[model samples]
Target: MEMRKEKAALSSQQGLNHSPFHTQEHMRRVPPKEPQVTCRSNTYPKGFYCSWHLQHPTYIPTDFEVYVQHNQRPLEVTRDEVHKNRCHVKFPELFSSFPYRVNVTAVNSLGRASIVFLLVVHYHLHRGLFGPTVKPDPPEKVVAKPVANNARRLEVTWNSPSTWPDVETFPLKYFLRYRPLIRDQWQHVELSDSISHTITDAYAGKEYIIQLAAKDMEIGTWSDWSVAVHSTPWMEEPKPITSTTESDIIPETTPGPPSAAPRVGEPTAACSTLLWSTHLLLACVLLSIM
Candidate 1:
């Protein structure tokens, strides 16, 4: 099966190289349409690749050739088997200001056509290709603390990734995610050109899990999230009592006699006076009777 597949691929390549419909004389009589070419660098200092396709079909076997020139000097070009119409070229220098000139030519039994592309060496070109591999390292020493006197705010700070060598040239943006320990959903914030951020909507007095990640502003993937940190917002303490305030809270009182009841007939002085008067009245009545 493998041998058969290989044979089939070779046959297809041969068929694309030559067409029976048009002879050499007929190819000279008719020409193919211009070929469209696109080139991009996937890795800086390594190389770039270019791919081309004809704008119109010529109904004949066609061949493509890619050529690259830098600073008026030609560079070596190699065919890419993955893409029959694509080719790769290595950079002569790591960082060169010279622009690259790429030409793609399509030739067939019917005719020949060509197109050109000029690539300028800029930061964007390098970033677009190898941005994933150039990711910044995770942020360092991430810390989260509650803002003083604020129950719903947390302050987070971190230093730039130590692995990133050129911070000035390629500034990094930050992504911070936080969530309460009891919650499954996370709240995220994006910070540009900042090392510190204040979360104004944190859950009051709740322990929160926090982390940070960073990436180049214009290119590269975000670095792995920084080591997680835990923090809860500050809670106000109960107020203390003062001398003046305490005095206002207390009420004044006067002294009072014990609430004991007096004996029924023990109003001794008044009761004795009444009994004497009654005895005198009785004696007067008896004398009258005699």
Candidate 2:
């Protein structure tokens, strides 16, 4: 048993040597500042997560190791993959009168700093200075699209954060903000008991960026904004005129013979009488000559 314990300690020391937070060389070395720890559970009662950070910069490569204890028994601390200084610890047993004790150690070539935080679970004389409060995760599955045939309307829809356990019992309110690419200002709306909203005043044909944030209805602060979605309001399309329609608008004219000349009026009766008299006088002169 002593040999096994020795091997386990050796393995843990080796793991620390390979941690990404540590570096061998020190340039502009400074001692680490006091660490601040925050722990919360989006799924309260089931579990909690603890994260820590430094108030001031150390100006050199630093290493951090976190240890957590509940009722004098050690709990497993999982370091965050993306954030080296942050870690998570899950509750093995729920609803305890004892407090969780967290110790954070910061080390560098120059010096080291350490701070311990005590967080109480299941209350009594522990005022919750360092807490396991209920903070929700960001809203998810956010989508934005243009309303069909509505040039000025853009519709946005989202689902509750999946990490939240019971949405119906512990409702969440949402905050939505959207803005067109051409403008720096954003339009915001607060919604409860609804997951969708239609922007009736959006600028037509303008592309917009939309995002959502969430908080529990009765407790905790708002979560971070979800991934942004891009969409543009609908625009009316012009209809094309076909050849048949154009022909109907302008009718064809058929060719026909040229119009006949206007008719001449008959001679007056006075003119006819004058013509007869002249003819009789001409006949008399002809008889006399004979």
Candidate 3:
């Protein structure tokens, strides 16, 4: 009987010990992790920093910590309040060979920290991110070369820069500006998100001074203007042409002679010559017939 009682007591002790662990295990379920950082471009540009974004996550971010390391050495340290569960960090010193990491810790009201998730930061320092520095290209050569016969339009071409860091996309936005040779005022044109542009609608054969600059939305900074270029359109002399040439070149033409009477000295040289020749021929015929 004593053995039976002792066995019952042992079983009771075992049950009591198992209940606490079972309840504790059931109560503790890990919360979901925060989202990862994302970028607008795949590659970060040279001499520029990148912005990393961590948006809303499974849990609300009330307080947070960020630690950035380069070559496994801490580079940046920051803390922020949670709003939209988003954070942006700019690393101006990031370069191609620099291997960097970021770890984020999120805390709850109870003061518990979630396991740190690692972030990878990449750069193109020595060699460009994707391709070799696009040949350290000089801004396109703008000679402002003057063309004969006042040239009316400007055609521009540039050598691709030696380094175009990889971004989400390319053929980025280009900015152009110019001033007429005679005017001190400046005129500007924006090529809505394109890398190349042809400037027309300019005075033909006129001397123009122009400038250009470019940037990628994914990239952080705008590239310097290509070498300042100077160009002049070849001046074209006015020429007289037949009606056929006029009709082809000029879309709108007078269907008939002008209704307004010619004023004194207004008759064109052609009209005056035709009138004089007709009178001379009539006088000659009268004399011959006589």
Which predicted model would earn the best TM-score?
2
Q: Pick the candidate with the highest lDDT.
A: 2
TM-score of each: 0.43, 0.62, 0.35
- Higher lDDT: candidate 2 or 3? 2
The lDDT for every candidate, in the order shown, is 0.79, 0.80, 0.54
* Quality of model 1 by C-alpha lDDT: 0.79
Candidate 1: which pairs clash? 31-111
Off by over 4 Å in 2: 1-27, 54-61, 70-74, 92-99, 118-133, 241-290
Cα error, candidate 3, residue 255 (Å): 58
Candidate 3, which segments miss by more than 4 Å at Cα? Answer: 1-138, 143-151, 167-170, 192-195, 237-290
Q: Write the per-residue lDDT of candidate 2 for residues 1-290, one digit (tens) a residue.
A: 99999999999998787765554433335788778888787765456677878888888788887889989999998887997767777767654677889899888877788889887655424222213366778888999989999998988999998888778866789999999999999999999968999999999888999999988665567888899999999887889867676547877789899986645775567878999999999999999999
Q: Candidate 2 at 80: error in angstroms?
A: 2.9
TM-score of 1: 0.43
Clash total of candidate 2: 0
RMSD of 1: 17.4
